[model samples]
Structures are given as structure tokens and as C-alpha cells.
Target chain A: MSQADDLIHQPLRLKIMAALAAEKGAPLDFPRLKAITQATDGNLGSHLTTLEKAGYVAIEKDFVGKRPRTRAALTPLGRKAFRDHVAYLRAVVEAAEAL
Target chain B: MMSVSEHEARGALAEIEAVTRRGQTLKGYRYAGPILMVWGVIWFLGYLGMARLSPALWGWMWLALDGVGFAATLLLAAKAPAAAGGAAGQAMRTSLGMAAGVAFVLAIVAVFPKHDLLPYLALPGLFVGFIYTVLGIYLAPRYAWIGVTLFVATLAGYYAWPAHLAEWLAVVGGGGLFLSGVWLRSA
Candidate 1:
């Protein structure tokens, strides 16, 4: 069985990763991400920074018609990690069911 | 390495599912908004023309507007980001679905060649409503509500305001769809 991905194990971070993974390489703006995760601005920002530091996410900043926009996308490494973590979680459930 | 209990694992999986569903819903909204707006404009103009012009002119006007709508929808779908992959396939599917819808409408016209103008106007609206409701059942709940509203509005206009049915459909059916498109775009 694969080990748990500690960085993505947090509930909020997990939600973020799942949302990004669903996009299939499309970048989601910060506000949309926050809405999906239901996280506060400060809390979501801090978690996103952690993911970026770990090279699990790429953060893009740009101006959209004079308004600043922040978008997040899963890095290739992050996608692999998320897939492995999900597999691990499924294994855990299966093991428990077997016992 | 961190270890999680089976319960925790299950919970995490559920969270992932929920977020992924939300993401897919938002994506659907984004893709569908412009297409709906295009059709909304077509409906608005078609009905308005029917209301103001001679019956002889209505058929040609609708044909022109429908052609424009189809072309515009295809262009928008083709230009959408290909990052999700299978973009060409998606566009092909969209074109095929649209062709099917047009063919269905043509079949209805062929079967009922002598229908009244008011009922004719209502038929398309009802068909569109049914389509939207079905899409909502699979894609998002909001679409179902929009579909129901369109269906009800069409029936109400047909029954209550036969004299002004074309105008009523123009404002309510067309305008309602346009507003729904705007609402979905924000989602």
C-alpha cells in the first residue's frame, strides 16, 4: 500500500487538490477555489502557499482588465501524489472491510 | 509517514468527491453559458420577427437566425481551452447533438405541417425546456429549474395570451434564457 501524503492529508488542502485535479490541467482562479473549498481568504492563502512551497501546485498572478487575478493549478508531481493518496485511502477502506 | 484510520480515509474520499463534483459543475456552467445566451438571442429575435412580420417572412427569418446560432455555438466550442483533452471530440459531440436537435425539430415540422403559428412557437420552447431539464438532471440542479420555468412560461403564454403569444414568448422565453445564461456564468 502507498503511504499517506502528509501535505495533502489536511482536509482543506485535500479539497484544494481534488478541485485542481478535477480541472484536468486547467487553472482555477483563487476565488473559485475558495468557493469550492469553503475556506476563508487568509486560511486558503496560507494553505496554497504551503502547497506551492512543496512544488505540488503552481500559482499564477496576473491582471485581468486592471483587476488582479490569482489562479492555482496542480503540478505534475501534485497530480501523481493526489492519485497515490487516493489509492492509499481506498486501500485503507478495503483492508478494513476485509478484516 | 502518517497513518489514518479507515473512517478518516473514507471521510477524505468523500470530501474529494464533493469538491470534484463542484468543480465539474462550475466547468459545465462556464461552458454552457455562452451557448445558452446565443440561443436566447436567437429565440428573442425569431419570436419578435414572428410577432411583427408577415407569416410568409417568418420561416426565412427563423432559418437565418438558427443558422447563425449554430455557427456561433460551434465557433465558441471550438475555441474553448483544449487542456482538458479530447476537445475535438467534445466539439464533434456538440455538433452532433445540435444536428440531432435540428433534425428532431424538422421531423416535428414534417409531421405537423398545418399547425397554428402560436402552437408552433410554443413547440420549440417546450422542446428546449425539456432538453434543459434533462441536462440539469445530469449536470446541475439549476438547469432543471430554468427548464421548468421555461416550460411553464411557454404553456402560460400559449393558454392565457393567445393573441400576444408570440410577443410573450419573445420577452419571457427569450429573456428568461438570456438571464439564466448570465446567472450560470457567475457560477
Candidate 2:
């Protein structure tokens, strides 16, 4: 039976993964990610930390002209996980539709 | 979110699709607009040069303009902060690299003196249209419209006025890029 990935099952986290996955190797800045996911600063930061800890995302922080800029990209593992999760979701829908 | 009801599954799928679609569009083509516009203006000038200058001089001017546009595009791409990653990004990179290869080959062929092949001089325009079409089909379908418009115009120019094919390319294809830039920005 297909199952949703626990790490990526949350709505906001799923959205984040989807956006990151779309850009594959490219990193998205913090502001852009936040705007895409529509998450608050602290909430987003915490979720990012969680994903980073899981090795699902890589976060880079640097100073750009005296201002800190953070960028995030999905790891290969994270991309696979997101794909699997979506597939699982689709399977669920298909199975229900059959019933 | 874990439970997989029909409604929940549909919602989740939609959510995923929405983000992916948005990521595809909002990946910062906004900066490419001015580059296209600049190239368009340059090509337009090249068209005027074709009418007034000697063929050799006009060819040189066209080469210079192409070189400038190519360099400017590279510089702008380098400066863009967000780089698209996954499949879409890979496809984009692949298409661009392919276009460069095609342009290089076309440039080489263009150097050989064959007035008979002058009609094919506008091949670079066709190549650009092909790249746009590929990019549009993969990344943004809206851009495919521009590609289609360019391809059809180039074909029409080739058949309708082979004598002034290059000029038509500059007018139609260049204008198409300019308009595409504007359209993408609004999109």
C-alpha cells in the first residue's frame, strides 16, 4: 500500500518541496520561498530547519551587501520523497475512485 | 493530511500542481524582458542597414549585433539570483545549449559565400523560434505561442519574400521577441 511521506505530508511543507523540486538544482532565496509558500517567517524557518535536519533540503546563509540572504534547495532524497508522496496520493485517489 | 479520502487526495494533488505551475512561471523570466527588447532594437537596426549598406557591411553589422545580444544574454543569466533546478531547469539548460550549437553551425554555414543559400540566412531566426517553442512547451505554454508566432512568420518570410527574408526576420522575429518579453512580464 502506498503511504504519504510523514516528513513531507504537511500542507506547507509539501508546497515547499513542490516548489523546490520544480527548480531541481537551483536554489530559491528565503523571501521567494516564503512568498511561494505563504508561510510566516518563524514558521517557515522552523520547517526549514526540520527539513534541513532530515537531509531533505540544503540551506545556505551568506551576507549579500551587508544583508543576510538565505537560500534553500531540495536534496535528491527530498525530491524522490516528494515524488513518492504525490504518487501515493494519486494512488489513493485512484483506489477510491475505483471503489 | 494523511488520510486519503477522494476529496483530500484531490486537494493534495491540486495543491502540489499549483506550486509546481507557479514555480514554472514565477522563476524569474522578468529579467529576460529587457534583454529581448534590446536584441529586438538591434535587429531592427540591422534591417535598416540591409537596405542602406553594402551586403558585406550589413553582414558584419548583423554579426556584431548577434554577438552583443548573445553576450548580454549570458551576462543577464549569470546575474539572475534564482536558478531553476529540477526537470524544467534541466530542460531549459539543454534547450539553450542546443540552440547555441545550432547557432554556431548556422553561423559557420552563413560565412560560406552562396547567394543561393541566402534564403537560409534567416535560419538563426528559425533556430530561435525552435528554442522558444521547446522552452514554451516544457516550461511555460504561453511562451510556446511566441514560438509558434515566430516560426510561422519566419516560414512566411522565407516563402513570400526570399529576397528580403533577412529583413522580414528582423522585423517579424525581432518584433516577436520584443513582444514576447512584454507578454511574459505581464504573465
Candidate 3:
């Protein structure tokens, strides 16, 4: 299986990835991403940092009015990895089903 | 060799990109428009079709289905971390809660609704949902298109469709969209 597939298998990260996939464009904000992923800021930030380092997601920071904001979006490699992971998941499920 | 774990650690970013278009973020609502549009239209059409037949029965049924669909969507979307650990694992559960809230807010006006309130309900309900969806997209851009679609369709429906249809549209159309949202988000 590809590395993306293995990472996605992690459950929480998979869903976060999937949730991000649903949007397909635009960066998810910290608070909103937290709400969607049901993750704490620190926890989510931690995961996001991981994703960012992997080059699967891009993180951008800016100030909106008074507050500092951090936003994340999927990178090109990130997209392929997700697709490959989904394919692998399908294969795994299908293979399991065939048994 | 890139062991699956190391490979994932190295390449997981690729998954994020695959799911979302380049240059997209969850903070912006650009992607959330489509699902929202489809959802609004489906609900509006449902109401338009059903209201002409049985208002009272359909009204109650709409409320029930709305809750069912909304609940299912949220249950899948709004999950907390499982001892199962893994961000991927809890992500499914995370969707359920937010999905439920989104669907609820999207469908709330239709529940055991009065015709008057029902007619006026879509306007605010959709507007709020549109805003929420947009925000959600910014948090996670992958599915933001769903929110963007909903937002656009909602505005179109609100501006173009008649008030009478709101009753039926909200119930039936909302139910269908909620179901779709549930399906899409489940995986």
C-alpha cells in the first residue's frame, strides 16, 4: 500500500483529510476546521503541522482585522495521495469482501 | 524503503491536495456553493411538489426525515477522538456533529412548521447555513464546494422561487440534500 493509504488509515487523519476533500478548494480556518474535525486547537494544529510538513497541506497565516488566523489547504501531492489512499481503501474493502 | 508509516508521514500531504483543489482553503466559502445549491433546489422542489398534494401529512413527514437525515449526517461528521486514536478515525465521527447541526439549521424551519414560518424560514435558514458552510470550507477546503453550491442555490431559490414552495421545498428537498450530505460525508 502507498504511504498515503497508511496515513489515511489512521482514522482521525483520514476523516480530516476526507472533510478537507469535501470542500475541494479554499482553506479551512482554525476554528471551523476544529469544529468540522472535532479536534482541539492544539491537537488539530499538531495534525495540521504534520500534514503541512508532509507537503500534503499548505498552511497560510494572516491577520483578519485584529486576530491572527491560520488556514490550511491541500497541496497537489496531497490530492494524489488522497486519491491513491481511497483507491487502496476500496481495494482493501473489496478484497476483504471477496473473502 | 518508505515503510507505509514513514511514507504516509512523508506523503500524507498529497492526500490533502487530492481532496481539495490547489489554492483552496477551508476559510473561504468558494467551494461550498454547489452542495448548498443542490440542497436548496432539492428542498424547494420537494416542497413545491408535495405541498400541492398533502400539506399536513407531508409537513410532519418532512420534519421526521429532516431530523433523521440531519442526525445521520452529523453523527458521522461530528465525531470526537476514539480510543481508536488516529485523526482519520475520529474524523468520521467529527463530521456527524457538524453535519447534524448544519442539516438541522438547514432544515429547522421545516420541522412541525407553520406555513407562514415555513415560507419565511428558508431565507434565514439558508443564509445562516451558507455562512456556516463557507466558514467550514475555510477550516477544510476539500468539501467546501458543497457549502458554496448550497449557498448559491439557496440565494437563487430565495430570490426566484415562490413563498408557497418553501414549505414543501424545505421538507422534501432538505431531506434529500441532507441524505446526500450524509452519503458524501460518511466516507
Q: What is the TM-score of chain B alone in each candidate?
A: 0.89, 0.73, 0.44
Cα lDDT, model 3, residue B122 = 57
Q: Judge the docking of candidate 3 as incorrect, acceptable, medium or high.
A: incorrect
Q: For residue A63, what is the lDDT in candidate 2?
A: 90
**Better by DockQ, candidate 2 or 1:** 1
Look at candidate 1 and tell me the lDDT of residue B91: 44
lDDT digits (tens) for residues A22-98 of candidate 2: 77678889987886787899999999998999999999999999999999999988887888888998998888888
Off by over 4 Å in 1: A97-99, B86-95, B113-115
Rate residue B94 of model 2 by lDDT: 40
TM-score of chain A of each: 0.98, 0.93, 0.88
Which portions of model 3 show Cα errors greater than 4 Å?
A1-4, B1-187
lDDT by residue (tens digit), candidate 3, B74-162: 34333322321233233443435445665565565446566554444355445545654665555554344445555555566556765
iRMS, candidate 2, in Å: value is 3.0
Write one digit per residue (lDDT tens) for candidate 3, span A27-83. Answer: 667766666666687888888888888888888999999999988778888878877
Q: Write the per-residue lDDT of candidate 1 for residues B52-127, one digit (tens) a residue.
A: 9998887789889989988988887776777643444444465567668867886787688665656787888898
Give the lDDT of residue A19 in candidate 1: 93
Question: How badly does each model clash, as a count of residue pairs?
Answer: 0, 6, 94
Candidate 2 accuracy as TM-score? 0.56
